[model samples]
Target: MTDCGCDKAKAELEEYLHNELCSTDAEDIREHLAGCVDCESELHVGRVLTEAVQRACRETAPGDLRDQVLLKIRTIQATH
Candidate 1:
């Protein structure tokens, strides 16, 4: 496992939050976080933001959005 100082740890923190890091990198970040208060706090913030974004992104579009989009596309194509 490589050593990650504060900068590298902070940079990869979002990946860590999503559990997307490889074992070596994850462990390095974990070890860094254990000893770093600022990074820990940043990790918490990252988690909150990531979860909020994920929730927002998972929402389905309005019921008629697809129909509306298709209608618009068809209209444009007909005009062309």
Candidate 2:
């Protein structure tokens, strides 16, 4: 949401969040995040989004539904 559209910063953020960044890049992002209010806000939003998705996923699929999926997989595997 910054004037630059924050593309470079957002890329860094995506990598940082996934723990896929190299040490130097991660440190640079960490420094930027500490000093830049805009990027910090973006990072906070990203964390909230990640947490919300995790919580939502936990609420999906009943035990019976999982059994049904496993049963279907077994049926297909048996055919092939």
Candidate 3:
């Protein structure tokens, strides 16, 4: 919907991090991030936050969290 393409880039940023986005889509976002300081800063923040959360999760080692989450997802999926 945005002509600047920032909107699409922002929308796909998380997926880009997770390797869920197609190569072409990721490439487009990369291009935008390269030229756009605003998007680049935002991407940097997202990366930092993602790393911090991952580090915290590694430190905490919540034993039942994964199972609980999967169960919840399955319950939701089944309901849908």
Candidate 4:
């Protein structure tokens, strides 16, 4: 398999990390990452950032804050 090069790999790194790429494209990125330290480091950073964001997204707001936000939304909806 040919290396997809740094540009394509970097551009699609997010999609690769998220398993959003099709098999062939993903394979190309995989091949590129295997041989390129820079792109691999970039992929690692993307993975860490993605994991952090996912963890943050999984966290729930405090009940009081959630209630306040819901109340504000209802007030706005009522006015509209």
Clashes per candidate, residues 3 or more apart or on different chains: 0, 0, 0, 0
Show the lowest summed lDDT stretch of 10 residues, model 4: 1-10
* Candidate 2 error regions (>4 Å): 1-7, 63-80
- 1-80, model 2: which lDDT tens digit per residue? 22333566677787788888877777777777777788989999998998898899889688899999999999999999
Error in Å for residue 24 of model 3: 0.7
**Candidate 3 lDDT, tens digit per residue, 1-80?**
12338888788889887888877777778788888988898889999999999998878536699789889999999999
Clashing pairs in 3: none
Off by over 4 Å in 1: 1-3
Give the winner by lDDT: 1 or 4. 4
True lDDT of residue 74, candidate 1? 100
Which stretches of model 3 miss by more than 4 angstroms?
1-4, 61-80
Rank candidates by TM-score, best first: 4, 1, 3, 2
Question: Considering summed lDDT, which 10 consecutive residues are worst modelled in model 2?
Answer: 1-10
- Residue range 1-80, candidate 1, lDDT tens digits: 66698999999987898789998999999999998999999998988998899999999888799889989999999999
Error of 1 at 29 (Å): 0.7
All models, RMSD in angstroms? 2.2, 5.1, 8.0, 1.7
Q: Provide the TM-score for each candidate, comma-separated.
A: 0.74, 0.64, 0.68, 0.82
Error of 4 at 68 (Å): 2.3
Q: Runs in model 4 with CA error above 4 Å?
A: 75-80
Please state the error at residue 37 of candidate 1 in Å. Answer: 1.8
Ranking by lDDT: 4, 1, 3, 2
